[model samples]
Target: MVNRHRGETALMVSGETLPMRLTLGALAELEHAFAVDSLPALGERFVEGRLSARDIIRIIAAGLRGAGRAIRDEDVAELSFDGGLNGVIKAAIALLEATFGEDDASRPPQPPA
Candidate 1:
């Protein structure tokens, strides 16, 4: 299960439900993987929704690695997806959104000093 409010998502990889989140290091890795010159550029690229199999694998691998999981691109490529391609796509989107989605706006205002 994914807790959107907490930026925690569970992905089925290698027949296991692995927790994933993106750290600053993971985001930087993604920028480098996509050959983007800036973080905004990376975000824009994903917004365009154009990616190859290798790209998906890399992105998911980064998320796994960020969560302290020892996974590689090759391992990611071999993982079985019960939900097929759609599941992979969903997991990728969930991972990205969980990491970079809008800030929570429902919290109560801070008390005055």
Candidate 2:
């Protein structure tokens, strides 16, 4: 069960739906992982959209931990996703949106006049 208002997302992995959140501790861990000094800086890094495959793994792993799961990046890599790579990426994106809320950049571009 996910509570979007509380910044919660769900991950479909190994035939199960796992709840994920970016709790303060989890966000701090991400900050350290990215070598960023502040939460905003971490957010900025994501905004840059220059993430590697490893970065995706780390983000999802942290989200799992945030939801109180004893999961690791390596463990996450081993799990099979419901919708494959696309699903995995969606889960990470959802976690980020839950934490930071969606912005204009995430929305579809409007047609030019």
Instruction: Provide TM-scores for the models.
Output: 0.81, 0.87
Which one wins on TM-score? 2
Pairs in clash, predicted candidate 2: none
- Ten residues in sequence with the least summed lDDT for candidate 1: 99-108
lDDT of residue 39 for candidate 1: 79
Global lDDT of each candidate? 0.81, 0.89
Q: What lDDT is reached at residue 88 by model 1? A: 84
Which parts of model 1 are misplaced by more than 4 Å? 1-6, 104-113
In angstroms, give how far residue 101 of model 1 lies from its true place. Answer: 1.9
User: What would the per-residue lDDT of candidate 1 be over residues 35-75, giving only the tens digit for each residue?
Assistant: 89887888889888888888888888998888888988898
How many pairs of residues collide in each model? 0, 0
